[model samples]
Target: MSLKGKRVIVVGGTSGIGLSTAKAFLEEGAQVVIASRSSAKLSEAKQTLGGNVETYELDFRSEENAASLFKKVGEFDHLVITAGEGAMGDFRELPVDQAQTAFNSKFWGQYMTVKAALPYLNKEGSISLTSGVYGKRPAKGASTLAAINSALEGLMRGLAVDLAPIRVNVVSPGIVDTPVYAGMPEEHRKSMFNAIASQLPVGRVAQPEDIAEAYVYLAKNGFTTGTVILIEGGALLS
Candidate 1:
């Protein structure tokens, strides 16, 4: 894709799919600006990505800060939001308080971000959001995630219309082996992924790089809007 000299912003770009996508954009000669809640991760990511990519500290919770950052950065070509943590639990017993807090971070944060950055976004640019297969096919204990992801997909379609010429799209990845599962024991996490992989039609889960390709397509393709590029490893098929 010819993204030469295009300015791109990656929210939650410190790690995982976001980080991988930023690298891909830079390789395509896009000027990449990365944002995340953690300053330490941002610093680490910068050192790893070299001097080409810019880093910004942004907590999605703070709309004022996000607005200020976008205003300062001026009009950029594309905005890719990969913020939010994965939340999975029984729907009935999911702690209302914590789930609500997580929801704000995951769902509402994206909405707030788009609202803040809309004024500065170039008409030719696009806003790419991250959703997942869980929205369509929830697993056991994935009730919360399924609900939130479903809502997120809805949010993307709504933003597509609201934003008009500025494209809005979502990439739905299926269980990429990212740091999001760091809370689990290493051995257990690996085994879990292995087991899940065995069940998938593709015979593997996604890598960060695999899902990153979808973002590149959405950002570079001008005709694609209100689209969900599912990068799952054929999990839904099985």
Candidate 2:
């Protein structure tokens, strides 16, 4: 789908899936804006993208910041939010503050971004949010993540109806090899990823580019809304 002349905003676009999505949109001739909390990362991303791309330093956890950032961003054809924190641990053992922090950063972060951007979005414009496979299927050591993911999906679906002419959807990706997992214990991480890859019918984990196609698809398809597209490499089927 051609996005020539379209203006798109990608929150959390400094790295991983969001960064990949921004590049894809730019390659399609769309004017892209990338927002994140890190100025250093944003600068790096700008240098990497190298064009007329706009960069904004945004802290989604702060409602004021979110509103201000969107206001400064003005209007756009698409708003994609991939900003979130991944908190893994047993719910009972996890600190309440930690869970709340995760929720504030991811769930409410996306909510505030959408709420702020809705008025600025053109008619038939789309809002894409990110969830995860754990939202649909439970996993060990992911209680907080699961809850937040499920909440994000529900938020998008409800907003789809409320937003009406504007579309809302979520992308749920599983086991993508990204820098986010770099902190995991080497041996354990390797085993975990291998196990995940082996279980999938596709015989491999996903990449940022793999899931990026889904985001581009949803953005271009006007009739599709209130849906969560899973890019789990068939892991959901297994």
Candidate 3:
């Protein structure tokens, strides 16, 4: 269970929660490799994560790329995948392409990563994927995200069985303050965050560091598999 000297690959580890999770591993004395689609972000993350962290520029959207990435990574102790494209919009107005983006990125991307990493993963090592609170409880303009996230949770269950001792689980976190909201208008984003913060029992929405710890827990726990570790800010309960 000890993470010291373990090798971990964090897909989407270039920024946000993924980056924070990577930092967590480094601090635990694990050998970390971070992969994402952005070379620039990867470089920046490497600097922020310190020189001990290794990095790879990866496009997990392609199964072949995912496989190739693991081939290069060789063997590892754990895999934490938090990279995905967010698709949110009104269901009635959604285009097929728009909806498919979420499926391709979050769901299928994680699937391919697992498939590829299995051969390289150390027996008993863990894989922690990401889901969301909205998967079980949706709101306006989140139909696509909800469906994709639900699918991911289901995928983790199946993966847990198929992968056996390798162990597979998911972390479903509530809204976190991250760059994922950068696309929103500043005032609107602030107002939305404030509103969510006010409503949550914890009095604040999650931050990347808040969610990152969950990933570490999943990695360290040997008995847990095929489970969804929900870390939402009591949004579902509220």
* lDDT, each prediction: 0.89, 0.89, 0.91
Ranking of models by TM-score: 3, 1, 2
**Comparison by lDDT, 1 against 3, better one:** 3
Query: Model 1: per-residue lDDT, tens digit, 134-180?
Result: 89999988877787788989989998998889899999999999999
Question: Per-residue lDDT for 71-136 in model 2, tens only?
Answer: 898878999998888688887888989989899988999998888887789876899999999988
Q: Top TM-score: which candidate number?
A: 3
Task: Supply candidate 3's per-residue lDDT for 106.
Answer: 86
Q: CA lDDT of 94 in candidate 1?
A: 76
For 1-238, candidate 3 gives per-residue lDDT tens digits of 8999999999999989999999999888899999998899999999999999888989998989988888888988999999998788899998989888878898899888888888889997999999898898987899889998899999899888888888899999899998899889999998999999898899898899999999999999899999999988889878
Flag regions of model 1 displaced more than 4 Å: none
Clashing pairs for model 1 are: none
Pairs in steric clash, model 3: none
Off by over 4 Å in 2: 185-187
Compared with the true structure, model 1 gives a TM-score of 0.97
Q: How many backbone clashes does every candidate have?
A: 0, 0, 0
Q: Model 3 TM-score?
A: 0.98
